[model samples]
Target chain A: MKIKLSELFFVCVKIGALLLGGGYVIVPLLVSEFSEKRAWLSREEIIDFYAMGQCIPGIIAPNTIMLAGYKLRGKTGAFCALLGLTLAPFVAILLIASFVSLLLKSVVVNDIFWGVNVAVIILIILTVKEVWSVSIIDKLTMLFFLTAFFMCIFGISPAIIILLAVLLGTLRAKFLKGEAK
Target chain B: MTFLLLCFEFAKIGLFSFGGGYATLPFLYHMSEVYGWFSSNELSQMLAVSSITPGPVGLNVATFAGFKTAGILGSFCATMSIMLPSFFFVLLVSKMLKKFKDSPVLNSIMYTLRPVCAAMLAAVAFRLFLESVVKFNNFSDFVFNNVDFKAFLLFVILLIFSLKIKKDPLIYLAFGAIAGILLHFGHLFA
Candidate 1:
């Protein structure tokens, strides 16, 4: 059966709208969405999409959506998925604006947000752990995590840290003796 | 001039931020600190708002930051800037997927990005932690009372549970929320 572009569009939007914990959550969801639910793609294909998604730039989920779109329908599919995924949060945020006053101002609610903020903290740290397992390895890479941790916690400039990491990472990649087989 | 500059700035994030959207946090943190387009507290609030909402945290953040910077137009410029790169880059990659599918050059570039990504994420988490835990306002309270043992104790308890729990972040968030509610309303808790 030929897939309608609209169905593909909503798939991306639905995934973006209800999903939690951000990009990492998208990883497994992509596997299930394309491989299991939609049956439009295979598991290996989704992984390939993820690899490509991570390799390029921007954000991962949109990239993944683009990849999934391509898998489902080709160029038009890719852009449509991108548009759908991108628009979801943009529209959601816009709607959220009307509630911003009450959400931020209420005393009882402020108490909830205060608690929620710490939970956000833990959630972020969990995200860090999830990404760490995938990206960081070796002593040098580990050092980068430590350095960045100290600089940020101490209120050092993040641009400085990013530039330093880029420089150091480039040098390490260039100068290191061994090649991965 | 302003619209183009804002696009260029966020576009840099699109092009460079490795690991993911959170990786853009450091660059953004610096933007807030150095440029004063947005304040540190505002950025923290943006981050919290982004996390609770659905979709990519990074994109949500860029939209919030942009909106704050240049109003609706800024929001448009910033969001589009970060987005365009990935759209084009992925398109380009998809075209050449077969040619570079197994290339070592790609692997090396990705490897080099690992630490930078870590640093970016660490920057984001650390800033959030400081904003939540560190109190710059109550400086005198430190010397005179040392009464923040309550906050300290909560942190320790939360930290332990966070580490021990299986995959639930909501548990900690709920824990923090309950504690906050109790502190404010419950007389016996304090």
Candidate 2:
């Protein structure tokens, strides 16, 4: 299970550079690279990493890669993965910022951006459907989805909602599932 | 001092912004009001560019905002600091994850978290859709104004195609850009 830092870095760098949309889309891309192609991790492990990404505080994409890299080769692997992921966007945006003032104008650029935005939104919605079918299993999970949805819409912070879910989940495990020690 | 301040502020954002990239929008909006680093309009433009760009939306905006406030160094600091928290956090949590792998409490937490995550994803997707596709100032405006029919139609077409074909997303993205230019040119003639 010893992974070369160079390989980890390059794989993540490629993913960071080419993958568009947002964090949710990163999961499928990672699965294809690590699980299907490399056999680095199983598909279920990637899904677990996706879940762990959600539970954590910061951005999902970086966190997921960190876990993947760490699982592969400990601390160095994690740093390599993180560096690979951030390096592309940092350089890309910095380059773009130089001419952003000009780019913001030109109705042509705006039109292209508007079209790309629509496409990215569609990509996100497709991810939503894919995640939803797997995540929502029964009445209780449905209730969790509804509660989270309303709480998000009502301007509640996501941290608070996630915290509340953890508390409720722990309680359920303790009393209802009867697995508490 | 400015570099440190930028790092601190972005670190705070990275620590707090949950759900995903779009969740950071509210905090960025607040920064515009208070910090004067970037305007709301510029933030929207950054968002658009970020969406089209190859990385996470939040990180891209942080870089743009930092570059706007100071320069290239500022962009580096802001991006690094924003991601710093997650870097340390994953290290810590993943270390502990092994010991707690079989704990029922952890299992239940994840079970419940899946649905919550689903809801958060759906909410952000819907919000982005409304912002991009649906245009109306108010309820009355909705009644009086026409929806962006072309964008809506394109969305439906792409959605169906993606679901059926299951191909790479870049194809749809390129198609969208082409369609956009054609539609814009078509409008010019009319």
Candidate 3:
């Protein structure tokens, strides 16, 4: 079930074309396209990549997609995926940036965005619900979620919170292993 | 020189922007203040455009900002530079994850990180909810008065439809745009 590089690039192009809201929205979209439709990756794998993507620097969507591509093919696949993901947006922004002043002035544009913005909220809410079911399992995980959520709300940098979680998780695993032994 | 500078600056942003796309806002704002490549007003406008456009908002902003700084080539350089760090880093991590797929320590770390990531995303959604669905005139405004009923209504209707139908989000987005236009016309006539 090897996918050609060209096909991979085109599939990614289609995904990139529809990525309207932001990184978080990429989760369900990729799940559907890859896991549901193509059977290339599992739902768990996509979410795992997404979580890892957030841990790394740069935009989450590209990092997740690049990892998916790497899994599907190899380095070339990753490169193609990255290129495809950026292509539409690069051209689009270039086009829009030139005439942005005019577009900004248009009441029609404003109205459309006003509505689209609301739609994006719905999308993000859906993403949170989808991710939550898989992430929060027990009391410890629940504690992790609550602490991270509050820290984020209170304006703590996400990088610090993530680092803390990783350190805490590693130490907890070691303690549990020692207890078992 | 401008292209080189754009590459260096954007690459730094790429390396540092954790969490998600919105996380890049602070860096972009600082860049705006220092470089004056685009005014703060223009940056907000770009953010608005980036939100509704069909792409990752961070990448869109980079493209727009780069173009503003040095035209087409600047945009290319900026985009590539911004993506470069993540590209290499993810590749390295992906390789490591595969190599250490069965390590209990690694598994525990991922298990813990999942909930934290979910929490971070929830936080992002909450902030967006405030920005898009609610509008407050000032600190003292009543909650009911502060909420934008029209947008809130649209959000509720779309949320219900999305939950019930489970269609591609593009369909709902299209429906939202049409509904918005209709609402605008309806207001005009009323």
Candidate 4:
């Protein structure tokens, strides 16, 4: 089925609003929607967009939206999708900002905020599962995941994690050579 | 000074953040440390709202953190600074994507970053978990009336379903939301 440029505009809205967990979480949804539901793109094409999006800036979702939009309707599609995705949340955040003083003041509101906070750990786990295939090549990576988690748990700063990751990754790449990339 | 720092800082996040929005967490941690504008705990909160709400996490964070630090102008600067690179890069890349779209080097980079990025997400997630679940107000209270076992069970159950079902994340999220509501009603769990 041929998807129209205007429909791509709505795709932007669907992605921007409903797509949560941010980052790569949008990928599986894009796969289900565009590849399976809308049939806008195929499995291979989605992977390609993901690869290229990773190589570039901002967030994966927006860049993927841009690439997907451009694929369907050129620059015009890109602009509309970007607009639809960016505008609503932009306005919503502004509106919420108007209430920030009040919202931040309530203890009950804060408790709920803490309740919602519990979900983020799950979000990250799910994100890891979604983006798993590329990263965890072997037990070395398993070790990395464990080490990283423990370090983070004990209050080691993430910058240190990044530093250690870069070092370990480089070492692994040296031994693995081309496999490390 | 803070405003200018916001622009420069977000610009750095814009340029280097790869994999996805959450991939920027490590950088956010660094920024928080450098400027001391926000704590890691607050950064985690910004992240929770950023993910669930509309717009990109990076974009939401720029707006949220910016507004927190300064005000309206911080929002503008944060949003614009984080977005400017992508807005222009999108225009530039869409033109060239057709030609170099199937490159192998791009594949290699993504493949490598994928694991590192996931680890980054996991790291942030772990910290958030400790803050939410592992806090101890007092030893006696902790010994007798401690542990939010219900939350932990809900998380585990939802995690199993999500991995097993492997469907849309919205299902797991809905389960999470419902769990939150149910947990709030003390009678239900008790």
Candidate 5:
């Protein structure tokens, strides 16, 4: 179907406005909006895009939306979808950030953040647990996790660590493939 | 000049940050350390703000960091730069969707990259834990006085509640804010 750029943009804006915590949260919303509600895309296609989004760099929500947009109406569709997806949150964050300093000056705000900080720790811990279930499946992966953890603790840059993992992972996979041959 | 630098740094972050939103934390932490654009304490605050806000946590934090460094224009540059990499990457992948989907090399990279990303997040969690929940006076001293029991208690409660209920993070964060206010009043009375 030839989806209008404005229609695509507005739909994505609605998604952006509802994107509360990021990550896989966008999946159900995308399935509902694009597949179930509007019929602009299929559920399976949305899932595929989401899986692809996870593997790629950048935030998954916009990445997935952009891919869907590209599929729908090529590049312009993707751009509009991206603009729609980001515009709401961009303005919202700018507004909050502008007043953040003034808000921080208030003791109540500070105290609330104090508690919120602890809450954030809980959130991070949950994230670690969630990632752990998917990422650390065996000894080799465990070693990868440990290596990166120690490197980070020892003050190595994360960008370098990620690069090293890519090299190591690719090499290991290649060796395993050769052995299987 | 600073805008260009922001674009460069965040674009790099965009290109490299895999897995999900929190994957960007390690890079942001490193950026904070390298540039002092915002302190670690402020990073945690930004994390909190990003969490409770209406968008991707990674994007929101980038916007906050940009705003912190160079105001509105900085934020615009930072947000756009971060998304730019994804724009091209996704477009490229869309054309080669079949090949990309079945590529063993990509699978292998993700196989290891996932753990690395998780580990980085663990490292970030550890740092935030020290800053917000506990403090060690020097590295050697381990004492009860060094621990913030109030924060510790709050952490335990929130963790348990989150695990059991599994609601949106916003709910827990809202509860946290209320708890914080109440705790402050309790401290005042005490």
Candidate 6:
């Protein structure tokens, strides 16, 4: 069954437009649209795509859309989906860039933005707490958290940190299990 | 020239900002240091707009940064570069998805990534707090003279409310904007 590029693009555009918050929030919407309504992908398949989204680096929301597009057609579908996912944000940010530049000049706007800054901080702290609750589950994981924290503060590149962490984790899993066996 | 630099820089951001949108902040901060494309002050404003506007927060920041630094083409370059890695991952790794799904090694890595991501976010949160809420020459200055008490109060209230309600973050953003304006004006009047 061949799906048209336009169809894939439009589906992604809809997803991009409606997707707010971040990657995780897109799950239910994607499930309903792709798996339930269009029948383009199965529920299990959507979950697989989401899992892949998390596993991969980059924004998870559009990653899921890209996978659905690939499953629907191929590379062309993938690009189309990526484009569609990007379109809303690209436009929205551009408009915001222009608007914020002007807004920054006004004293009242400055105060408003100051408040917004506080809000952003609150949101970030909440995100840290939320991720912390789930991430800091044991001694080994706690070690990872502390080491990663110090590395970041000292300005070691995050890409390197993530790679090292993944490598250490894989090695520990392999070797520790062998010893146990 | 500039366009390509924009692409390279944002692609770097795209490649590294693991965890999620907020994770991009540290990378963007680095870019601000190296490029002089935008000031740290402007980046704070971009963060505000990114939150208020629709779309993934990281992508929105990338787009805003691109536009500020260059123009329309820069926006395209930045957005595309940031998104390119994800596309590549999907194109390449989708095939391995099924095979790796149940692999213990993969599971371990994912489990390990969770804590690392949390730590990264915590780092960003602390840095941002220092930059926005307290401007001090040193730790003692922060402890004494430099803390922005009004901003700190707003942060505490917003944090408590958000945790209690867990509503759409947009509401808080709106509240912040209004509260900021009122506070600033009230100070003038008093």
Worst 10 residues of 3 chain A by lDDT: A120-129
Candidate 3: C-alpha RMSD to true structure equals 5.0
Q: Mark the regions of model 1 whose C-alpha exceeds 4 Å error after superposition.
A: A134-136, A146-181, B98-101, B136-154, B168-184, B187-190
Stretches of candidate 6 exceeding 4 Å from the true structure: A22-24, A35-37, A42-44, B140-143, B184-189
Native interface contacts kept by each candidate, as a fraction: 0.53, 0.68, 0.67, 0.45, 0.79, 0.70
Q: What is the C-alpha lDDT profile of model 3 across A65-124, one tens digit per residue?
A: 999999899788889999988888788888988887787687877777677767766665
lDDT of 3 by residue, B84-168 (tens): 9999987888888865556778778777877886787677667666755676423666487667889888888998888787766
TM per candidate comes to: 0.84, 0.78, 0.73, 0.75, 0.95, 0.90
**Clashing residue pairs, candidate 1?**
none
lDDT for each residue of candidate 1 in A87-108, tens digit (9 for 90 to 100): 7788776666447666778666
Best by lDDT: 5
TM-score of 3: 0.73
Off by over 4 Å in 3: A1-61, A64-77, B1-48, B56-58, B61-78, B93-97, B137-146
Query: Residue A126: error of model 2 in Å?
Result: 1.5
Give the better candidate number (5 or 6) by lDDT: 5
- TM-scores of chain A across candidates: 0.77, 0.72, 0.68, 0.62, 0.93, 0.84
Candidate 2 at B81: error in angstroms?
3.4
By DockQ, the better pick of 2 and 5 is 5
Q: Per-residue error at A137 for model 1, in Å?
A: 3.6
lDDT of 5 at A137: 97
When 3 and 5 are scored with TM-score, the better candidate is: 5
Q: Worst 10-residue stretch by lDDT in candidate 5 chain B?
A: B135-144
How does residue B105 of candidate 5 score in lDDT?
87
- Candidate order (lDDT): 5, 6, 3, 2, 1, 4
Model 4 over residues B1-190: C-alpha lDDT tens digits? 8888899888777766656777767677777767888887777667656656666677787788888778878887887787667767777887887665565544444444456667777766665555567654334555524556766676677667766766654455556655666655665457
User: Which model, 2 or 3, shows the larger TM-score?
Assistant: 2
Q: Which ten residues in a row have the lowest lDDT in candidate 1 chain B?
A: B137-146
Q: Please tell me which model should have the higher DockQ, number 3 or number 6.
A: 6
Which sections of candidate 5 miss by over 4 Å?
A: B137-146, B188-190
lDDT string, candidate 2, A1-181, tens digits: 6778898999999889866866657888899888898999999999898778766667878888888998998889888998998888888998888987788687888888778777877766666576678778899899999988877655566656667877888888888566433
Tens-place lDDT digits, model 2, residues B109-131 = 77887678667666666655665
